[model samples]
Target: EETHPVIIAGFGHFGNTVGRFLRANGVNATYLDIDSDRVALLRRMGFKVYYGDASRHDLLRAAGAAHAKLLVIAIDNVEKRLEMIETAKKHFPNLHLYVRSRNRFDAYELLNAGMLHVYRESLDTSLRMGVDVLKMLGHDAYHATRMSKMFLKYDEKNLKKLAAIEDREAYILEARTRMEELERILQEDTNNRLMLQVDAAWDDASLIKEATQQATAQTE
Candidate 1:
C-alpha cells in the first residue's frame, strides 16, 4: 500500500515552506491545495500536489488523511481553516493536527478548539527582525537573541493565559502587568550576563568550514 504519513492541506507560502523543509529532511508528504492554478504550476515544477478543498471529508480521505499520521493545516482562509479542523476531527480522529494561525486572535480560536500545535505566521519572523534591530543598535548578538527567545516563551504562555479571561478590561490590565513583568525579567537576565560564550563553537570560521564540508560532500 502506498502511504504518505504526513498530509499537508494547502500549498501557499507557509504550506510550501513546511513541505520543502520536510522533503529536505528526506520525509515525503502528500499535498492537497484548493487552487487548481497552483496545483498545475507546482506539478509542472516537479511537485506532486493534488487539487481539492481540504475541508471536504471525501477529498481528505482520497488524499490519505485517514491513514496519515500528521495533518498540517496551513490554509490562509479563517473559515476554511476551521472547517478543515472540524472535518479532520470527524473523519480522522487519530490524526495529529498542526495548524498555522494568522495572528494572536486566530491562535486563541485554535487553542480554544483544542489544537496544541499552532504557529503564528508572522510572530517568529517579526521577533527575529526585532533581534536584528537590537543588534544593529549596538547590543550583543547573543544577548539580543536570548532576549527574543525569552519574549517568545513569555508571550506564548501569556496568550494561553489570556485566552480564558472573559472580561476585556481585566485582560488588558493583566496583559499590561505581564508586559512589565517580561521587561523586568529581561533586564535581570541581561544584568546577570546570562549569555552563551562567544567561543570557537560560535566562531564564523568554524561555521564556514562546516558549511563548506557539507557542500563538498553533496557535490561528491
Candidate 2:
C-alpha cells in the first residue's frame, strides 16, 4: 500500500511557508532540506523535517519518496531543482511535483518533463503585496491571501484560454469579459486595494487591445 503524504523539499522561504501553511490547515506534511540549521530549527519548532538532499535516491527513499504524494521543490537553485525532479520522477514514479521555477525557461523545462503545477515563486505574493501597499495602509492578511489566490486562478485561466483562439475580436471580447468580471469581483471584495483596482482596469483594457491586435495580425 502506498503511504502517500505531502512532502516539501528545500527549507527556504517557499518551502518553510508551505509547510507552515499546510500544518496550520491541519494537513500533515514532511520537510526535506539540505540546510542542517533549518532542519534543526523546524524540528525544534515541532515539524516533521530532516536534513538531506532530495536528488539522492537513498535520501529520498528514506524520506518516504516511494509513498510521497505531493513533492514541492522550493529551492532557489535552478540546477538543484532539475536534479531533484529527475531523481524524484525516476525513483518515485507516482509523485506529483509542484515545482517553483525562476522564469519561463525553467517553467518550460519542467513542463517538458511533464511537471504541471509549476509556480513562479514570490511573483504572485509580491504583486499582491504591492497592490495592497498601493491601495492603502490597511492590510488584512487572510483576505489579501485569499484575494491573491483568486486573482492568480482567474489570471491563469484567462491567459491560457486566450492563447487557444485565433480570432482577434473574439479574443478581445473574452478579455473584456474577464476585465468586467475582475471589476465586479473588485467591487464585491472590500479587501481589494483601490489603486490596484484602477491599475487592473487600465491593465486589462490594454491587454485586451493588444491581444486583439496580435490575434488579428496572426490570422491575417
lDDT of 2 by residue, 43-140 (tens): 88887777877778888887777887888889877888888888987888888889987764456566666777878665686767766774576766
Regions of candidate 2 where Cα sits further than 4 Å from its true position: 1-4, 137-220
Candidate 2 at residue 167, lDDT?
74
What would the per-residue lDDT of candidate 1 be over residues 166-188, giving only the tens digit for each residue?
A: 78899889889988998898898
Query: CA lDDT, every prediction?
Result: 0.90, 0.77
Q: Note the residue pairs that clash in candidate 2.
A: none
Q: What are the models' TM-scores?
A: 0.86, 0.61
